[model samples]
Target: MREEHVQDELGRLLAPGRVDATAALELLIRQALAMGASDLTIEPRADRFEATVRRDGVIVPLAEGPRDALPNVVNRVKVLAGLLTYRHDLPQEGRIPADSFGADLDFRAAIYPTSYGDRVAIRIFNPSHKDYELPDLGLDDETRDRLSAAVSRPEGVVLLTGPAGSGKTTTIYALLRHMLRMDAERRARRNIITIEDPVETLLNGVTHTTINEAAGLDFARALRSLLRQDPNVLVVGEIRDHETARAAMAAGLSGHLVISTIHAGSACGVFSRLLEMGIEPYQITGAVTAVLAQRLPRRLCAACGGRGCDSCRSTGFDGRLLLAEFASMSSDLAEGIRAHMRLQDLQAIALRQGMVPLARQGQRAVEASLTTEQEVRRVLADA
Candidate 1:
């Protein structure tokens, strides 16, 4: 359908009187998927309910409807997610399988109560689309080569650092797939295990497990137990706490090639974050192999030269490209960590040793006309 046609359909579906909440929600999700959105948000206000879709790291308005009809729509989503419909005062989360809508996508639903009404956010995942190999991630040649070399090591922690929704998990999965293919080529069967908060993708021949905090199975506990399973490569979804961070470092030092993601602004920031998590400097120096920091900048629309086009929803962006920097462990870097060197000094060493910053990567993209400078700045403003 054309852009105008989609808007017209949404307008009719979200019309004030006698709305079919279920049908409206279905249309919204279908439209979001068509736009390559990673998330859909439905927020209730005093007089109306607003919907937005996040695509290429930007949130664009979708539609709005009468406040009276929002409850029905929220209830429909709750029904699909199997959330408690009666409890609107508390926060709740649930999952809606693709089978519910007869689509090839999974929806993770979260509801939080506000003074006005309940707010609903849904994350869409297409697990069947597993093309996120290292090459597919759009890493520059040098960064890709560095990352591949880091992951090829037998026993060390290769950490991916980035903010939330920065595609860290996707990159980690790609690395895992790359390793699996390598193992196949060598005809060497190696044990690989992963522990995630929610196992997003189902990978064949790899042990994928999820943390159940309610069942006393958290990341730290899960890592301790998995250590006994003789895993050659361990993938921890994220290190969120002190215990998990300690366990991950220990695993790396104990001869397991550990791969994980952590919330850090840059490759150099990962060390400080780990130190803040109570990890000893010696442990970090001994166990960490590399840190890869990344971001996703919206690519400019080719159809309209970034001026605005119906094809890009008038956002001048059609898709996203990766901006990444890799910092590998070196003898000098290890010594710096052991000596408790400042982050700036450590970063200087990384630069001297041929590490590129994310800003430099973004500049390259801009020069190539792959994305706009404004978009790159927006994505890296915090950095």
Candidate 2:
């Protein structure tokens, strides 16, 4: 569609009281997609409703609607997501599979009660967006080779570690696509299953299961039954608790390739996270094949020449690139983990084995002018 056509449609949809509830909901979603937003936050206040959309890891103001027009928008969203519209006293969660925005998009919405009204947060996942390959994820040749080799193994766990919004999901999806491409006929004979809170990307020949906590089906429960289905490859969205971690470890040890994400500051920190989840260090060493930590730094707009320019939306930065650090469980690293070595000692061993640390990757990005030192520091300050 032409840019002018889209702008005209958006203007009509967002004409406040002119549109009904359904039209108002579509207006908000369409506006977000047009702005390339990853998330939308709508909070109801005493006199008005506030909206913000997250773009390129930064939150930008979207709109503030008059109090009268706000509830209709909220109600329309709830109805589409299959949540209880009459109740605003408790937290509610729902998902909507939508295509009105011209792509296959999944909307995960959550409503929570507050003093003023229900606050709604919606996460938008576009499966129709271009799929990425290994190189497209910005992995160096060596790191890519190591990860490819690890995933090629018959059975083991590969964990992608990073804080939220660090592109872990995208990396894992790319890896899965690569694996499927290696031998389509062989893969066709195998059962691949993914258990996610809300399955983001749609993969061919894979069973995607979204977690339903309200229905009493969570990661741990879903995984237990999934094992009976005899899957050759299993993907867990996020290993948040001890139960899910143990289930993933067991599935991996029992000859299923397991992939999952965890919240850790670095690859080495993944071991500590597993241990803190009540998993034994020896168990972690036995099940873990590799851990990859990734971050997304906003790349400087080439058209801007590192100065704020219209092409970059005047943010100085335009797009994003991957900065990754990884560690594999080689014999030495495995033994160290089994022996419960210090984190520093283990990291040193990996470094000697030619593993790149996050700081070095960030510095490389800075030198290449893909981003700035300030951007790197902001993304990796904890690392």
The candidate scoring highest on lDDT is 1
lDDT of 1: 0.87
lDDT of 1 by residue, 86-171 (tens): 99999988999788666877899999999878899999887744459889998878888888888888899999988777888889
**Which run of 10 residues does model 1 get worst, by summed lDDT?**
1-10
Q: Evaluated with TM-score, which candidate comes out highest?
A: 1
Q: What is the alpha-carbon lDDT of model 2 when measured against the actual structure? A: 0.83
Backbone clash count, each prediction separately = 0, 0
